[model samples]
Target: MRTAIVVGAGIGGVATALGLGRAGWQVTVLERAPQLGEVGAGISVWPSAVKALQQLGVTGLEKASVVSAPAGMRRPNGQWVVKASALGLELPVMVHRAQLHELITSGFGSGVTVRTGVTVDGFADGAVRAGGEELRADLVVAADGLRSVVRDALYPRYAGPRYSGYAAYRGIADVELEDGGGETWGRGRRFGFARLIDGRYYWYATENRAAGAVGDVWSAFDQWHDPIPELLEATKPEAVLQNDIYDLPLPLVPFAQANVALLGDAAHAMTPNLGRGACTAMEDAAALVRHVTGPAAIPAALTSYDAERRPVATKLVRVSRNVGRVGQLDGRIAAAVRDGLLLTGGKVAGLLARRRSG
Candidate 1:
């Protein structure tokens, strides 16, 4: 039987393991954490990612259309920049990150073996050393994350994660709210929230700041419009999670080196501006299964996977970075210009929508 090793038990890593298992490949998942679980708050699963999740064996993900109501980009004072109905945006499946992780892990079969509390020290020539154990496999997947050990082994000299000059605060507010949440943008900061599948609200705030700076989520968003303050108030202070945003330098390439593949953040970590980070990783896992399940050998299949996914992921990384720059614009004049353009663009889009309907 074909054997594979997945570094990191993140959403991407687990999905890859499950998919490989379904493809009849035995998979060993290594995690430095002592237990298997996911942290963080809500995650937005776009339509494409929903399909990928379904393809990977998650079910009962029906989201009611009622959640897609009147909402749009707004200012700090709650002025609407662009309405959702006008944008005709596709609604994503909002879910708690832990719940989503559980769903994916449930798909794991006997062929998948998860070893937590195991640290992956490094790799060389396609062999991974984890927890003092030198491991070899038919394939090595670097889903480890931004500071991936496997990725360093494959491309030691490549520039890795670059800071986005912003940090994000994420949390789940157990309290109920009546608003159909959307993002509120202010100079150098932004806040967004959405109703999760489990009836709680997931909220996040981004601020332009130096990496590793201490933050007060409440102070950052307290002056914003309704529900922004409320969301933070409802959230436990300790439950608030913050991380400086970073992305791997683009051209996300050579996803496969020899028999090893760089998956998820290890390959294309991007700003959450478009919320495509995890979604794209899920897509990578799906694509891997598609190519590897065929008659082609592992290396050739991974080559096809890299060819198909690299371009798409690269484009997303670039766009997301640009969006982050705009979203986190700290200068008052620049932010005003950005909002004005977005409002004007939204009007034109609305006009086009009406014209097409007429």
Candidate 2:
């Protein structure tokens, strides 16, 4: 029987392992954390990601539920800048990252082995060194993450992720919302909120700074505008989760080498501006499984994966970064221009819809 080793048990890693196991590969998943959990607060799972989850038999989304609704954006002063329906599907269905992790982890059957508290240092040929133990397999999938050690071994010249010059402060509060999701754009600052399935509002704020914790991030937004202060003040400090935003460079040059292949953030990391980060990762795992287990040669399958995903994902990364600029526009004139463009162009509506679809 074919054997597979997947590094990292996060969304991408677990999904890949589950897909491969379902495809008849004996799989082992290595996770550094002692126990699996979600890193960020709330993640928006769009239709594309949902489709992939359905493929993997992740049937617990409704049970581990966060709120589901259409998403919108506003200015710092609390004025609506842009609004759009989620269309046939909900723009975002809020779910705790940890619950999502649990959903994927539960899919690993007898054919899959999961190792927690184990860190993968590097990989060579068809083997990975994890926690000082060497394990070999017919194929190694590096679903590790942005700082993927496997990716570093495969392409050291690529270095690692780059900071997007902004940090996001996130939290969830038991506040009454209008049953919708919203984002407030400010000068080099941004804030947004969504109603989670648990009936709590998931909110996040962004600022121009390095990727790390800051003192009193809510205090930083105290003077911004309406609702901003209310949202921050109403929440407890313990609930807030903050991290700097970063993205991997695109054109991942060569996504594979012989029996090894990169997936998820390891392959094409990008900003969350479009909220397609996880969705794209799920798509990558789904696409790879179809090819690898469908009678195509390893090299040929990888070639097609790169060909099909590179152009679409590269475009997404570029567009997402540009959207970040739009959200963080500084200066009075720049803000005015952004507002004008959004209101007059009516082009943003379609662009946003496309983002959700991908």
Which residue pairs overlap in candidate 1's backbone? none
Displacement of residue 9 (Cα, Å) in model 2 is 0.7
For model 1, the stretches where C-alpha displacement exceeds 4 angstroms are: 63-70
TM-score of each model, in listed order: 0.97, 0.91
Separate clash counts for every candidate: 0, 3
Measured on C-alpha atoms, candidate 1 has an lDDT of: 0.87
lDDT by residue for model 2 (1-358), tens: 8888888887888888888898789998888899876687778887788888888767889777654565566776667766655333356577888778888888778999988899888787667998778898877888888888888888879858978888878887777756466777888888887777777777888788756647577667888666667677778998787778898776565667777878888888898898889888888888888778878778788878878877778888899999987887778899889987886554555576678789
Residue 25 accuracy (lDDT) in model 2: 92
